[model samples]
Every structure is written in structure tokens, then in C-alpha cells.
Target: MKESDPNKKEPIGKLISYIHRTQLKRMSRSLGEYGIGGGGQYSFLKAILMSPGTTQDQLTVGLKFDKATTARSVKQLEAAGYIERRADPEDRRSHQLYPTHKAIEFQPVLQTLLDESNAKLTRDLTDEEEDQLIALLQKLNLED
Candidate 1:
């Protein structure tokens, strides 16, 4: 066991870490049930949909993924016909990401999965508690 340092600790780490781990597992299972397998693909899909021509590098940096993994995952999605890489009118060297019709077809399914996940997570919490939890997560993000 590692020695404990009395001076060191985040007051909220235990609850925060539990929430994070549980969220990831639930997200994975939700995506798995939807045939998306939850991964960088989910991030990529969301990023591209929000800013329809985002570059691979933008995804790598924005999503905090390694460049190679981002590239490979994009390639996989491309092969699966979920997304397309188009020449960026702004930059000849970088291609932009766009969702294909195939991906759009899956949007409703994905949304249902998200709705279920959200309902499960909030089933026992009041509206105020949900808001407080979100505020706490937002505070944590500001720390980063």
C-alpha cells in the first residue's frame, strides 16, 4: 500500500471518482446496446455534428485523444460509412469530417440510449440535486 500524505487530498475525490467510473461504464453499456460500442467514435460523432467539418487534429486536441488513435478511429468510421472526409475549403492539407446518411439514421437510436442513461442516473435525484451534481462537475472542469 502507498503511504498516505496527511497534507494531500481533494475533499471530493472519492465521490467524484465513483461518479466518473460509474458514468463511463454506464455509457459503454448504453452504447454497446445501441451498436456504437462507445469510444472515441462517440466523441468524434458529437464533435463533427456540432461543428460539421472539424479536422482530425481538432478532434485529437479537443477530445484529448492521441493523434494516431483519432486518425485510426476516424478511418474505421469512414470504412463503416458513418462519416466522410471531405476536402476543407479553408485548408487544402486538412480534411473535414461530416456525418453520412448512415450516421444520421442512427441518431434517433443513440438519443434513445442517452435518454435511458440520463433517466437511470437521475431516477433517485431531485431536480435540485441534478442541478447541483452538474454544478459540481462544472466546477471540476474549471479546475482542469
Candidate 2:
């Protein structure tokens, strides 16, 4: 078998996966002190904070996570004192999620951490390049 060319461009999926893993490591380290679990947990918390009273189903769909992942993240966030679930009057089987006072107080810090992480991720790129990269990534259909 012939060896592949080292100069060949990597596949987009591989590149995206690598970038995702790197981002997750950075986020996990940054959020460890605040009791937020790594990966999608902080994303779930942010969504709940931004839109209180959202349901788990909504989060699952909006965040593109499976139902079980959404449920698990919510549970972890609740146990960490960042969020609470209240009974939904409209649906007895479902609960609405809300950020607790702890989460509210930490919201600004959360935003700052996220901003710093993003800035680090794009530090090598010019502002225009960053904007173009964002636009190009957004053009992909990453649903499910």
C-alpha cells in the first residue's frame, strides 16, 4: 500500500472533531472551579439562563442533543445548584427549567469565560478572517 501524502488537506469532519475536542478541554478546565460539568452542561445552563421556563424537550431540540443527554445535563446542573425544575402547569408530565440565584449571579462570569475562550480560539485570525470563518461554518447543516 502506498503511503498517503503528508501534505494532503485533512477532511472537514476530522478537523471539526479535533477543534471540538480542543474546545471541550479548554472549557472543562475553565469551568471546573465553578462546579459546571464540561461539554454540553454549560450550554444547557446558558440556554436555561437565557430563557427561563424552557422545557427539557425544547432544550433537546434547540441544542441538538438527544433527550437523554439533555436530561442528564439538566440533572447535573440542578445538583450543582445552578438551576431548578418546576412543574409545568400546561403539561403534568413535563417540567420547566429555570436558573437559580446562584446561576444568575454567575451569569456574567460565565459570559466572560465564554468570551475569553472564543477569543483564544480565534486569536490567530484577523477580525475579517474570524468573521468569514464563522459565516462559513454556519453555512454547514449540522442538524442532528
Candidate 3:
């Protein structure tokens, strides 16, 4: 096989990977001041805030993250005083996660940050283009 040409168009997966890394870097920088480490920590916090008493297993599945990643994110959030874990009423072995007062207070700020991030990401796109992009991406069949 011949070496790939540099002039060739980049693969879709490569473009997606680059975009994901860029977004993560931006989000990490923005969230660091609030003691929220990146790697979807904000996502976990938001989910807990939206649906308090959700279990780690549910987060893992809902967010398409591995169990270990979910556990690690939960631990970090707990250490940062953003969330708490309580014994599940239905199952003693499982713990239900809840956002703490700090997280509740930060919810609005988080929303603003996320909105700003999204705006920045799509600054060059027209409203219709952005909607079309979202619709196209959603059609990629990302379900597990």
C-alpha cells in the first residue's frame, strides 16, 4: 500500500476526534476554577443536579461511560464538595448521587458557561447550519 497523501481529505472520525479534544480543553479550562476537573465531570454534575438520587450505574449507562470512569468522576465531584452519595433505599449496596448546595448554587453559572462554550463552538455557523449539523450528527446512530 502506498503512503497516504497529506493532501487527501481527513477522515470523519479524525475530524470528530479533533473537535472533541478541542472542546474538552476549552471546557476543562473554564471549569478548573470551579474545582471541576474535565473528562465530563460537569456532565455528571449536571445529571445529578437534574435528577438527584440517580445511581452511578444509571449515570454510567446514560452517559455512555464505563463504570470506572463514572466512579472516578463521582469521587472527584464528592471531593470537590459538589456532590454527595447516599445509600440507595432500594438497594443498600448501591449509592444514589445528589448535587450539594455548592453545585445547586453553581447550576446557573454552569449553564452560562456551557452556553458560551457552545456559542463559541458554532460561532462561524449560521443558525440553520447549526440546526442541520445537529440533525445530521444525531442521525449517526450512536446508541449502544
Candidate 4:
């Protein structure tokens, strides 16, 4: 009898990491066309799209990223013309980030890529299984 691959029994972390790496690679290619690189900037842009005029501090907290990391991503996005930062009238020391027209125009394309990738990943699963998987993943991400 042939031996089964031990990797088949690898922990969920390995599988999740693999998926994240593959998605980042795909995003690097797909988003490069739009002048966005991998480095987690996709999520940052999406967050700004969802809430225009969000503060840098808000982004740091919302994304669970360090302040410096958020600052760097914000700077890159701003320089790339995907986002514009304006002084927050409410908070003189902080700035609010907003997606520019260029970034807004790429929303559908990004959404399509996201949807297609998700469908491809869950293609073999039934609706119930998909829902259960989503629920389980969400549970895992929840703060204890």
C-alpha cells in the first residue's frame, strides 16, 4: 500500500497561510495594473472606499495594524493617486483619507476578482458547506 502524504494532515494555520500567500500573489498581479501592490494595501484601500474621510488613527485601529504600518500604507496610497488625505477639520493634528476617482473606478474590477477567487475556492462545496465554512472562519477570527 502507498503511504498517504503527511501534509494532508497539516494544521489549519498552514492551509490558511497558503491561501493568503496565493491570494497575495494574485492581487500583486491584478492590482499592479491599477498601481496597487500586494503589501496589504488592498484592504486599506477597500476600507477607505467603505468609509471615505476615515482618519489614520481609525484605520490603524480598524485594520488592527500598527500606527507606523498604517502610516506607510497611507503614504503609499496617497502617492499612487489612489487616495487623497485632507486635514481633518475636527482634529487638526490628524488627516482623513479618501479614495480618489481613480480608486473608486477600480472598485468593480476589484470586486469581481474577489468574487471570482472566492467562488473558485469554494466551487466544490455545497451552499450549506460554504456557509458553514464562512461561519467557522469568522468564529476563528473573533476576539476571545
Candidate 5:
């Protein structure tokens, strides 16, 4: 195959990958200002959003995290007032993980931050271009 000419078009994939990762890290740093950072807290918040009463073992499966790490993360999140664990009446040793009032209140801010980040990333694209990009990505998914 002939090598692609950089003069014709820049390497969009590589640029997007680098910028996306960097911007994600930077955007997530804002979470620290609200007393949340690192240690699987982001994953924990996302999991609780999807599964309000999920158990730690369930989190292990759903989030693809290891046992010890899952336990440690839950402990930290619980202590931070981001989540609450309720004792299972049926299962003596099992506890269900749910979002705290504080976390529930913060959901809109999370969504706004995500929307702002997405907007920043795609700020240069027109509506038609955004549609085309999404379609192309979906087509690539089919190839995989």
C-alpha cells in the first residue's frame, strides 16, 4: 500500500486520541475541587448511577475491577459521603451500594461537565460533519 500523503490531510485519529485523553484528565481534575478524586471514585459513581443497589461482587463483574481494588474503592467512596451501603436483610454479609444525597445532587454537574467537554472537542464540526463522523464511527464498529 502507498503511504498516505500528510499534505492532503492531517492524521485526525492520532490527534483526536491524544487530545481526548488529555482533555479527559484535565476535565476530571475539576472533580477534585468538589472533594472527589482518583481511587476508582469515578467508576464507583458511574456504577451506582447505573445500578443503585449493586453489590460489591456485582461491581467486580460489571465494572471489570479486581476484588481487592473494588473493596478498597467502595470503602473510600463510602467514607467520602459519595455513596451509602445498606445491609441486606436476606444476605447477612452482603451490602448494597447506593448513591448518597450528595452524589445524587452532583449528577447534573457531572452531566454538564461531560456536555461541555464534548462540545469543546467537537466545536469545529458542523451539524452535517458531526452526523458524518458518527456514521463513520458506527460503520467502523461493524467492521470490527
Candidate 6:
């Protein structure tokens, strides 16, 4: 196969991957002041905060993460005092994840950072383009 030309159109999947990596790196740096080591745990914390009493198994399936990754994030957040794990009433084998006061307090700041990143990413796109992009992304996401 011929080498791809940089000046030519790039694959959307590759572009999205680059964006994901860069965004994660930037988030990790920005969140350091708040004691959030990396941005990986942010989503888990947000999910738990949004749905209190969600179990680790639920998080694993809901977020499409492996069980080990989910468990590690839960453990880290719990150690940071950002979340608490309690025995599930229905299933003693599983534990429910819940956000602590610290996690709740950090949400607004996290949201602002996310909003800013979104605005920056879409700054070049028109309103219609932004809507189209979101629709396309949703369609792609649903394919999985």
C-alpha cells in the first residue's frame, strides 16, 4: 500500500483517537491541582454521582470498561475519599458505588472544564455542523 499523504484527508477514526489521547493528557494536567491524578476516574465518579447506588458491575457494563479497570478506578476514588462503596442490599457479592461530598463539590468544576474543552473543539464549526457532528457521533456510538 502507498503511504498516506498528510495533505490528503485523514481517517476519522485515527483523528478521533488522537483527540482522545490529547484530551486525556490535558485533563490529567489540569486536574492535578485538585488531587485528581488523572482524568480516567472522572467519568466513573460522574457516573456514580449521577446514579447513586450503581454497582461496579453496572459501571463496567454501562461504560464498556473491563471489570479490572472499573475495580481499579473505584478503589482509587474510594481511597481519595471521593467515593464510597457499600454492600449491595440485593446482591451481597457486589458493592454499590456512591459519590462522597468531595466528589459532589468537584463536579461543577469538572463540568466547566468539559464545557470549555467542548467549546474549544467546536469553535471552528457552525451550529449546524456541530449538530451534524453530534448526530454522526451518536450514530457511530450506537453501532457498538
Q: Tell me, by lDDT, which candidate is best.
A: 3
What is the per-residue lDDT of model 2 for residues 1-144, given as tens digits with 9 covering 90 to 100?
A: 256688998789987987888888988899999998876688999999999999999999888988989988999999999999999999989999999999999999999998998999999999999999999999999864
TM-score for each predicted model, relative to the true structure: 0.75, 0.93, 0.92, 0.87, 0.67, 0.88
What TM value does model 2 have?
Answer: 0.93
In terms of TM-score, how similar is model 1 to the real structure?
Answer: 0.75
Q: After superposition, how far is residue 114 of candidate 2 from its true place, in Å?
A: 0.4
Q: Using TM-score, give the best candidate's number.
A: 2
The sequence of per-residue lDDT tens digits that candidate 3 reaches over residues 1-144 is: 356789998787877887888888999999999999989899999999999999999999898999999999999999999999999988999999999999999999999998999999999999999999999998898764
lDDT digits (tens) for residues 40-85 of candidate 4:
8888999999999999889988988888888888898998999999
RMSD of each: 4.7, 3.1, 3.5, 3.2, 5.1, 3.1
Judging by lDDT, tell me the better candidate of 3 and 5.
Answer: 3
Error of 3 at 33 (Å): 0.8
After the best TM-score superposition of candidate 3, give how far the Cα of residue 139 lies from its true spot, in angstroms: 0.4
Ranking of all predicted structures according to lDDT, beginning with the best and ending with the worst:
3, 2, 4, 6, 5, 1
Deviating ranges (above 4 Å) for candidate 1: 1-18, 33-35, 141-144
lDDT of 5 by residue, 98-144 (tens): 99989899888876876787788789999899899888876664221
lDDT of 6 at 6: 77
lDDT of all predictions, in order shown? 0.77, 0.91, 0.93, 0.86, 0.79, 0.84
Candidate 4, residue 10: how far the Cα is off, in Å: 1.7
Candidate 6 residue lDDT tens string, 73-114:
888889889899889998898888888999899899988887
Candidate 2, superposed: residue stretches over 4 Å from native: 1-6
- Per TM-score, what order, best first? 2, 3, 6, 4, 1, 5
